[model samples]
Target: MSIATISTFVTAALVLVGIALALLVGTVGVAAYQFFSQNRRVRVARREPLVGYYRTLAFG
Candidate 1:
């Protein structure tokens, strides 16, 4: 095969590899964000203390 033909094939393969890597990194970033956000919400909920009995429970 001619050198030019081989170079073209290599370039195409590299481009495809770059696109696949970008997609993989993007997916991982999105998943990490969701996981961290949910964890933060759970921590916040756990820290909140109950105020007291509800109005109906109070004799008044």
Candidate 2:
């Protein structure tokens, strides 16, 4: 009922929300990277130049 108590509750809620957002974003990013990498690999396998280019960029 007090302002101080309400402020504390709001702070805790905001922190939890922030943490949840970070986790969701991180998961989405990882999933996107994997999907793109797989697609790139598939394309590379279907072509020689792309595969070579990817390899050169990765290791050379």
- Whole-structure CA lDDT of model 1: 0.72
The superposed Cα distance between candidate 1 and the true structure at residue 22, in angstroms, equals 0.4
lDDT of 2 by residue, 1-60 (tens): 999999999999999999999999999999989976877876677775765766766798
| Every candidate's lDDT | 0.72, 0.84
lDDT (Cα, 0-100) at 50 in candidate 2:
64
**Residue 7 shift from truth in candidate 2, angstroms:** 0.2
Extract clashing residue pairs from model 1. Answer: none
Tens-place lDDT digits, model 1, residues 1-60? 999999999999999999999999999999988866666555566664223222222353
Q: Could you tell me which 10 consecutive residues in candidate 1 have the lowest summed lDDT?
A: 49-58
Looking at model 2, report the run of 10 residues with the lowest lDDT sum: 48-57
